[model samples]
Target chain A: MRIVVLAGGIGGARFLRGLRQAAPDADITVIGNTGDDIHLFGLKVCPDLDTVMYTLGGGINEEQGWGRADETFHLKEELAAYGVGPEWFGLGDRDFATHIVRTQMITAGFPLSAVTEALCDRWKPGVRLLPMTDDRVETHVAVELGGERKVVHFQEYWVRLRASVPAEAVVPVGAEQAKPAPGVLEALAEADVILFPPSNPVVSVGTILAVPGIREAIADAGVPVVGLSPIVGDAPVRGMADKVLAAVGVESTATAVAEHYGSGLLDGWLVDTVDTDSVTRVKAAGILCRAVPLMMTDLDATAQMAREALTLAEEVRQA
Target chain B: MRIVVLAGGIGGARFLRGLRQAAPDADITVIGNTGDDIHLFGLKVCPDLDTVMYTLGGGINEEQGWGRADETFHLKEELAAYGVGPEWFGLGDRDFATHIVRTQMITAGFPLSAVTEALCDRWKPGVRLLPMTDDRVETHVAVELGGERKVVHFQEYWVRLRASVPAEAVVPVGAEQAKPAPGVLEALAEADVILFPPSNPVVSVGTILAVPGIREAIADAGVPVVGLSPIVGDAPVRGMADKVLAAVGVESTATAVAEHYGSGLLDGWLVDTVDTDSVTRVKAAGILCRAVPLMMTDLDATAQMAREALTLAEEVRQA
Candidate 1:
């Protein structure tokens, strides 16, 4: 089977690891959200892409579910000492090598897709990883801080501010102009099943979908388009998904999230057993819905969740 | 007294430490050589300027005479793992921070002089450090590599090749078109005494002089221009100075080095006690010459050498 996954950072990366284990024989192509990419210390940092790459390649900090394992923050500390930073973003020494290489290649006129491919050449992440769009598409959040409204990059909103203030709006700044990276539309078109792992819908998977051609391609792909809820029991499984979901006026519930993606793009939706009650509401909205174990507690449990999603996809295809 | 010093990397940095100790209250301005600067991994690596800053800031590796004292090469190792490198040059984590800051600032349209000043805010290296030129003035060494005469970067020749082959020519690639950095000529004009540290005569001090207006500024400054010879006992005290000195057709000897500068530019010259017999030969060339214990074995010994240079400067002023 050829599976295409739209991934964010930690949660999506962790889920992809499970997906890899569950469908060992399947060819996986990951369309990583680059909206969270930030240039820190003049180097390009693709948080979501690096997470997926490192997680699958065994270089990830398993505990944090992002960044390189055994990493040192000496470079970050030194940068801070020089008063050059967004000291809030923790870019470790080992992790910095990735950005440096990516930035160097990008400056040398290689597109981000080509650079991603070159970087993956080292990780051999098993799956081909393509950035959603090579063009700059930063997710910015409009928030009221100190009684003033301001738009901040997704990273500053998420990593620095910790999403403390209410998000008034969440905008994928350059998505309207960005074309899907070279292989993205083809992968979706060729996919047997398209999965949205339990990543943030508003700024992660949502931003990738916001790219001009990507959402249209997936909707037209003729594959079983399925999604696993990031929300369970009216709360996020991980991360502050509810906060940004509120910005888009989506309720922090599995059924609400499924309805937000809507029946047009989603063929199947998976809610956790904890939110089993929401399955009927989601199915009533014209998309097939199933309640399964959605928490990625460990590799095996996560793999079982992946298997459940695949089974749900088969049910949607048959129906 | 206001003192101006022309400096290179390790040797120049070590000599500055002694000069600082010798004239504790003297106002020192260092015109640092930038020809050895190179871009590696898409970051500007200013070896000589950094050496001076780190050495004076108490961050230098005492044994190696360059880089940070407690440096780690994790970033470098990771870069190598990604197969991105000219692996020979060792840029530690701490050192990489400096280059990253510099590269970022430069890209943001700050000249190297402004970047250097901003960097010094953290190092507090006491002396005002200025690059010889703000314009890119790279030193290229022409050598026979694999039996083909080719020109390579100064860092490639010195660090990578270790100056293994004879240097056929040492050219400061952009010197003719390059103007002295802001305050370089002013520093020379205002100098009470100008001292040339025992840095490489060919690439270090010579390259600085190659900047269009700097040599003229120093000669016209009318202040005592005294130089401590890098060569002692018909050989360089440290580094492979002889290989490059030969490229310029100057013999690697204390007396010969003084003659190479000539009386028009050099007011006084200091050679080691071993080269005492050749003091008259240097004097015959119309520049005042002295023989002193020039070995910088320790701080106190190096300080004595700085004091001797200052004393010689006073004698030249009287003459």
Candidate 2:
């Protein structure tokens, strides 16, 4: 089966690792969110893309779920010695070469899609990783600090501040006019099943959908569009998903997440067994809903979740 | 007293360490050659500038004499795993950060001189280090590979090829139109004495003079432009200096180097004791000449040579 997954960083990388185990023979194409991309120290760093690449390519730090394992901070110290560090985020020295190569290729007249393809040539993550768009579509969050509104990049809000404050608004800066990258719509159209892994709905899938023509292409893909709930028991599985979801006015609940994505794009929605009671409200809202074990504790558990998502997709296709 | 020195990589770095000890109170300015500068894995790497920075900042590896003292290679290994094994040149993980910051700052509307200043802010190298120019003046070498004229970047020729193959021509690509970076001329003009360290005459010092107005400023300084010989008894002090000088039509001799710079720029010249016989020959060319222990074997020895150069400068000033 050809499965297409739209993903964000840590959660997305972990889920894709599981998906690879679940369907080894299934051709997986991941449309990764580049909204969190930051140009740091003169290199283009796509956190989500790198996470997926490293996780699947077997270079990821399993504990940190980001950066390469056995990474060193030589570059960071050198940068610090040069007084060039805003060193909140853990940008390991080993991880920097990837960003540097990507940036170099991009600067040398290649679009990010081409540069990403060139980078993937070495990693060969067994899945085609396509960034949502080649253009710059940064995700920014507005917050009130000292009774004044201030906007910061997604990485600053996520990594540096650790998202401590409440966000007034979340904006994907260039998403309104940003066109989908070349392979995005084709992957969606040719996909047997499109899955939204337990990634941030607001930032991951929402950011992808916000890009012009991508959501419409998925909606008309004529394949089952299944979304697994990132929230269960009124809490996010991991990360600041709940905090960001709150900014977008979505309660950390399965039914609310479903209602937020709404009946427009989702064909099948997977809720955790803990949120089994909320399935009716989701189904009643004109969407096919299934309750399943969604915790990706290990590869087997995540594959099981992947199977559940695919099974729900089959059911929606039949209906 | 104001003093200027032309520099290269490790050997030059070590020599500068001695020069620092010798001229602790002199206002020293380094005319660092960027000919060996290369874009590696997408980062702008200036080997000589870094050598000067690390050495003067007390971060230089005493043993390696190039990178940080206690450096890690985790990033380099990772880059190798990605099959980017340009394994000839040593780019330690700690060192990559400097290049990244420099490249980043340079891309973000800052000239390399300003970036170098910003970088030196933390290193506090004490001596002023200036790049030859802000312009991209890449040095290329024409080599006969299988009887075909192939032009390769200086680093590839020097590091990868190790200058084993014969070089037909060495060209500094943009030097014809490149202006001296800000402060370069003023440093040359205000110098009480300018001493050329035991660096490669062709690639290192030659590239510095290639910048449009620098040679004239040094000639016009009117105090004295004295040089310590990189060549002692026909062989270079270190590296592939002899081969590169031969490529530029200069013989690997103390007299030939002084003759190469010629009567036009230099006022006084110092040769190794081994080349004492050539002092009279060098004097005939209108440059004040002296035979001394020009080889900087240790700090005390180098300090003696530096003092000798100053004494010669005074004698030349009287003449």
Candidate 3:
């Protein structure tokens, strides 16, 4: 079976790790969200892509579930000493290497997609990883600061601001004009099943879909497109998903998130057992819904969730 | 007293340290050689100017004579792991900060001179340090390599090859079209003594003079123009000065180096005591000459040499 996953950063990476184990024989392709990419110290840093690559390639700091394992922040410390900083974003020494090679290749005229391929050559990530789009598609968040309206980069909004302020608007600035990266549409067309891992609905999977052709391709791919809820009960499983969900005027609940992606693009939705109450509302919205244990407490626990999503996909296909 | 010094990397930086000690009351202006500047990994690295700044700023790795003290190479090691290299040049994590800040500023449209000043604001190196030109002026050395004649960067010749091969020609690629940086001519025109530190004459002092108006300004300044010979006892006191000097058809000897600079530009020449015999030869060429203990074994010794150079300058002025 060929599986495609639309992924964000840490949460999505963890889910994909379990999916790989749950369906070992399945060929996996990940269309990573690049809207979180930022230029730091003149180097193009694709945090989401790196998280997926490092998580799969055995370089990730297992404790943190992102960044390199034995990473040092001497580079970051030095940059701050020079008074060059957004000091909030934690880019370690090993991580800086990825950006350096990536920036070097990009400057040498390699597209971001091509650069991602070159980087994967080193990581040997089991899944074929492709960025959502090669063209710049920065996610900018509009907020009111100091009693005045202001706009900030996605990273500044997320990492720097901790997404504290109610986001007035969240825009994928260049997504409307972006074409799907070379392999993205083909992966969708060839996929036996498509999964959205429990990542940020607004900034991660949603931002990837915002690219002009991606949403259309996934909607018409004719495969069982399923999604797992990032929300459980009244809050996010990890990260500040509620802060951004609220920006799009969506309630912070599993059923609301499934309805947010909507029945047109989603065939199956998985909510945590704790939010079993949300299953009815989701199913009533014209989508097949299941309640499962969604906390990725361990690989076994995550793999069980993956198995459940795949089972739901089969059920939706049978229907 | 107002003093102007022409300098390169290690030797010149050490000399300036001594000059600062010898004349603490003097307002020193340093016209630093930029011919050795190279863009590696897409960042502008002015190695010589950095040497002067770091050395004077008390951050230099005293044991190595350059780079940040107690530096880490995590960024470099990671870059190599990604197979991004020129692994020959050891730029530490602390040092990478300087390049990153400089590259960022230059990308943001600041000239090299202004950037240097801004960087100095943190270092507080006391003297005014200026590059020979804000424009690019890379030194290229012609050599026979791989059974073909090729011109490699001066750093590649010196740092990579250690100047083991014979040099065919030495050229400062952009010096002909380059104008002296701001305050360079003004520094020279002011009624003061000008001193050439014992840096590589061919690549350091020679490259600085290659900028059109500088050599002419120093020759016409009429205030005593004195130089301490980098060559002593028919050999360079430090570095592979002989290899490049041969390319310019000058021998590596105290007297020969003075003759190469010539009486037109040089008013006084100081050679090591071992090269006392060359003093008469330098004087025979119509320049005043002296023999002094030139070994910079410690700070006091180096300060004494700086005092000797100033004394010789005064002697020539009296003559």
Candidate 4:
């Protein structure tokens, strides 16, 4: 089977690891969200793309589910000592090599998609990874800080501020003008199944979908489009997904999230067994719904979740 | 006393440390060579300037005479793993931080002179370090590689090739069009004594003098311009200075090096005790010459060399 996954950072990367294990024979193409990409110390940093690359390639910090294992923060410490900072973003020495390479390639006139492919050559992440759009698309969050409204880079909002203040708006700046990167539409068009792996709907998967033609291509791909909920029992299983979801006025519930994606783009939806009650409401909204164990507690548990999503996709195709 | 020094990498940095100790209360301004600067992994690596900064600030590796004392190569190893390299250059993690900061500032439109000053804020390297020129001035070495005469970067010749082949020509590529960096000429004009450290006469001090107005400024400054010879006993005290010195048709001897600077710019010259026989030969060329212990074996010994250079400057002033 040819599977296409729209991935974010930790959660999506972890889920993809499971997907890889569950469907070992399947060809997977990952469309990674570049909206979270930030230039730190004049190097391009694609958090989501690196997360997926590192996790799948066995370089990831398994405990944190992001960054490289056995990584040192000497580079970051030195940069801070030089008073160059966004000190909150934890970029390690090993992790910095990725950004340096990517930045060098990009500065040399290679598109981000080409740079991603080159980086993946080292990781051999198994799946082909393509950034959603090569053109810059940064996710910015509008928030009220010190009683004043300001728009901050998504990283500052998420990593630095820890999403402390309420997000008034979440904007994927430049998405409207960005064209889907090469091979993106073709991958979606030829995919047997498309999966959204419990990533932040507002800024992760949502940001990728915001790219001009990507959402339209997936909707028109004629494949079983299934999504696993990031929410379980009215709360995010990981990360502050609810905060950004609130910015888009989506309730922090599995059924609400499924309805937010809506029946037009989603053919199947998976909620955790904890939210089994929400299945009927999601099905009532004209999408096939199933309640399965959605927590990626370990590789096996996550693999089982991936298998469940595939099974649900088969059911949607048959329906 | 206001002292100005022309510096290169390791040798120049070590000599500056001695100078600092020798004249503890002297106002020192160092015009650092930038021709050895190169862009590696898309970051500006200013070897000479950084060497001076790290050496004086107590961050230098005492044994190697360059780079950070407790440096790690994790970033470099990772970069090599990605096959992104001219893998021979030894840039450590902490050293990489300086380049990254500099590259970022330069990208944001800061000139190298300003960037060097900002970097000094962290190192507190005592002297005011100014690059010879803000404009790009790369030293290119013409050599017969694989039996073909080709031009390669100065770093490639010195670091990668280790100056294995004879240097047919040493060209400071952009120097003819490059103007001295801000304050370079002013520093010379106000200098009480200008000293040339025992840096490479061909690439280090010579490259700095190649900047359009700097040599003229020093000569017209009318202050005592005294130089300590890098060559001793008909050979360079350190580094492969002979290879490049030959490219300019100057023999690698204390007398020849003094003649290379000439009496017009150099008022006094210091050679090692072993090269005492060359003092009369240098004096015949119309520049005052002296024989002193020129080895920088330790701090105290090196400080004595600095004191000797200052004493020669006083003698030249009296003459």
Candidate 5:
């Protein structure tokens, strides 16, 4: 089976790890969102890409789910001593080299997709990882801080502020003109199954769909497009997904999240066992629905969720 | 008395530390050469300036006489993992952040001198350190490599190649048109006495003199300018100073080095105790000379050298 998974950061990385375990013989292609990318300390940092690469490459700090394991902060301390500190975000010494290489390649006129591909050469994360777009699409959040409305970069809102303030609006700048990376649309067209991992729907899958041809490609592919719910018991699995979802007027409910992705893109939807009652409502929204254990506790648990998602896709195709 | 010191790295940093102990009240100003500065991993690195700053700030690695104490190299390892191994020169994790901040500031339109000042704000070296120029002035070494004449950056020749290949020519690119940093001329004009630290006479002090008005300012200063010998018993205090001097067609001897600077700028000179017989020969070159124990073994020994240079300046003034 040729499975193509759309991913964000931590949630996406964890899900992919399980996806591999569930379908060991299948070739997996990952379409990672680069909307949260930020240029920091004079280097380009793609948080989602690094998370996926490090997690799959076996270099991730498993407990933190981001950055390289066994990292040091000597560079950050030195930057601080020079008073060049953006102190809120922790950029470890080992992690910084990733940003430096990506930034250098980008400055040398290579697109983000090409840079991501080159970086993956070192990690060789079993699955083929492709950035959703080559264009400069940055995720920004509108927040009122110090009694002033300002749009800060995604990292500032996510890492620095820890998403304390309500996101008035979340904008993926330059998404409108961003063309899908070369292999992205092709993967969607030829994919046996398209799985939307429990990543941020508004920022992850939504950003991938925002790229010009990607959404159309999946819609026209005539294959099962299934999405797993990130919300369980009216709360996000990880990160500040609810805060960002709320910025776009989406409620923190599995049913609402399914409705947000809507019938246009998703043919099947999988919600957590706790949200089984909402399956009827999700199916009523013209989407095939199934209730399953969606919390990825471990590799086995994650594989079970992946199996459930594939089973749900098969049922939707039959229906 | 006001004192001016021409310096390089390591030994220069250590000697400067002792000079501070010897003349705690003198307004010390350092005219650092920028020829050895190199851009690595997209960050500008001024090894000489950093040496002086870290040495005086009490953050220098005492054994290495360079880089930060308690430094980690997670960044370098990561960079190497990304296939960015500039394997020749060692760049510690702590040291990289300084370069990042410097590159950021320089790219933001601040001159090198102003950047040095801003960096010194945290270091508080208690002395002014100025680069020879704000403009780019790199030293290039022409050598026969792979049976073809090619020029490589100074760092590559010095650190990477270890100067094993004989340099056909040594050129200070852009030095003819480069201007001395602000306060350079003023420091020389107001100086009651000046002493050259035991740095590479050709690369360190020679590069400073290569700047348009710096050499003229020292000669025009109505004060005694004394220099300590870096060459003791026909060998450098440290590093490949002898090889670099040979490339520049200068002999590796205290008398020869003193004569290379000449009486045009220097009013007095200090040779190591082992080279006491060369004192008369240096004096014959039309500069006042003194035989002194110039080895900077410790703070006491270095302070003694500084005191000797200062006393020599006084004798030349009174004579």
Candidate 6:
């Protein structure tokens, strides 16, 4: 089976691990969000991309669900000691090897997508991983701080501020002009099923869809396109999905998120069993909706969610 | 008093430490060689400049005579793990900080000389440290490996090969076209006395003089210019200085080194007491020569050598 997954960070990585378990022989192509990419201490850091790579490649910090396992922060600590900062974003020593290789390749003039492919050669992530766009796309949050409105990088808003203040606007700075990286459209065209992991609809998957032609491609792919809810019972399963969702004036409810993505690009939606009441409302908004136990408590539990999403894809395609 | 010193790695750093103690009130400016500077993992590694800074600043590994004390190789280990190398070069985690700061500042468009000044701000290495040139000048040594004559980076020859083979030629790649860094000529022009520490005659002091106007500046400055012999009893006091000197056709002897710098550029030369027999030979070459106890056993022993150099400067100034 040829499956294309549009992914974000920790949650997406966990879901992919589940998907790999559920479909071991499947040919998976991942389109990773680069909106969270930031340059720290002069090294390029793609949090979402690295999270997926590490998790899928068996190097992930299982407890945190991001970064490398057995990682040390001595590199980051040294950077801090030099007073070179954004000390808030943790980059461990083992994880830093990823960024160093990546930055070295990028600085040598290879496009980021090419660099991603080259790095994947080492990780053997069991999937062809490509960045959403080689061009830079930083998600900025327009927020009110100390009664003054300011725009901060997504990481600053998320990691530094912990999204404490309401984000007045969630902006994907370079999306409109970005072209889908090579193989993206072809993968979409060849995909049998496309899944959006329970990643943040506002900044993770939404920021990617904000890129021109990508959303159009998925909408036109004629494949079963299904998404699992990042929000369950009016709360994000992981991360600060609500704060940025609120930036776009979307409510934290699962139904509202389905309405935000709308029926144009989505074939089906999966909400958690805890939000069973919202299934009918989400279906009423035109997405073929189902309620599944969505808590990724373990490998088997997460694999069950992946299996359920694929089952929904089958039902939507048959209908 | 104003003092200008030409320096290389460990020996120069140790001598500078002694010079600091010997003339506590004197204003000292160190012209550090950059031919040994290299780009490893896309970060600039300035060995000579950093060694001087670290040794004088109390950050140097005492026994190893380079790198940082209490250093970890996690960063280097991680780099090796990625298979991105020159695995031969040892860059410890703490020392990586200096490069990160330097590369960051240089990438932000600061010249190497300015970057050195900023780094010195952190180290507070007593002497004003200046790179020989802001422009890149890598020392490449021509050698025969498996009957193939090829030029390799000096680090490759010294670190990887361990200088085990004969170096056919020693070339400073960028020195011919290089301009002395800002304040280099000014430092030379305003100097009351200049000393060449027991540094590599080929790569260190020689590379510094290779910059366009510096050798002329020293020659025309007309102040007493004294040099301490790097060789003790026909061998370098430390390091593989002898190996590179042979590549340049200079015999590895204290008298030959004095003759290599020659009477035009050197007014006084200090050899170790063991090379006392060669003092007349150096004097016959028209440079005033002294045989002093040159082993830098400790700070006090090194300070005495520094004092001897100053005393020689006074004698030469009178003559």
TM-score of chain A of 6: 0.98
- Choose the strongest candidate by DockQ: 1
Better of 3 and 5 by TM-score: 3
**TM-scores, each model vs. reference:** 0.99, 0.94, 0.98, 0.98, 0.97, 0.97
lDDT of 3 by residue, A1-319 (tens): 9999999999999999999999999999999999999999899999999999999988999998778998888878878876778899998877878887898899899999999998888888899999999999999999999999999999999889998898999999999999999999999999999999999999999999999888999998999999999998879999999999999999999999999999999999999999999889999999999999999999999999999999999999999
Judged by whole-model lDDT over C-alpha atoms, candidate 2 comes out at: 0.86
Best by TM-score: 1
**DockQ sort, best first:** 1, 4, 5, 2, 3, 6
Clashing pairs in 3: none
- Candidate lDDT (C-alpha), each: 0.94, 0.86, 0.93, 0.94, 0.89, 0.92
User: What global local distance difference test value does model 4 have?
Assistant: 0.94
How do all the candidates rank in terms of TM-score, highest first? 1, 4, 3, 6, 5, 2
TM-score of chain A of each: 0.99, 0.98, 0.99, 0.99, 0.97, 0.98
lDDT per residue for candidate 4 within B207-244, as digits (tens), equals 99999889999999989999999998888888999999
User: DockQ of candidates 1 onward, in order?
Assistant: 0.87, 0.71, 0.69, 0.85, 0.83, 0.61
Q: For model 6, how does the per-residue alpha-carbon lDDT over B295-316 read when each residue is reduced to its tens digit? A: 9999999999999999999999
**Model 4: residues >4 Å from true position, as ranges?**
none
Q: What is the lDDT of residue A232 in candidate 4?
A: 92
Clashes of each: 0, 1, 0, 0, 0, 1
lDDT of 2 by residue, B1-319 (tens): 8888877776666777777777788888888998778888777899889999998888899776677788888777767766776877788887777887887788788988998888888888888989888888888999988889899989889878989898889999989988888889988888888877788888888888888898888888887788778898998877778888889788989999999989888888989889999999999998899898876666788778878878888898888
- Predicted candidate 2 versus true structure: per-residue lDDT over A1-319, tens digit per residue: 9999999988888888888888899999999999999877767899999999999888899998899898777778667766666788788887987876787678789988888888889888999999999999999999877888899998999888788998778999999988888899999999999999999998888898899998898889999989999998889988888878989999999899999988888988999999999999999988999899989888899988888888888999899
lDDT of model 6 at residue B38?
94
Worst 10 residues of 4 chain B by lDDT: B230-239
Where model 1 places Cα greater than 4 Å from the true spot, the runs are none
Q: Please tell me the TM-score of chain B in candidate 5 relative to the true structure's chain B.
A: 0.97
- DockQ head-to-head 3 vs 6, winner: 3
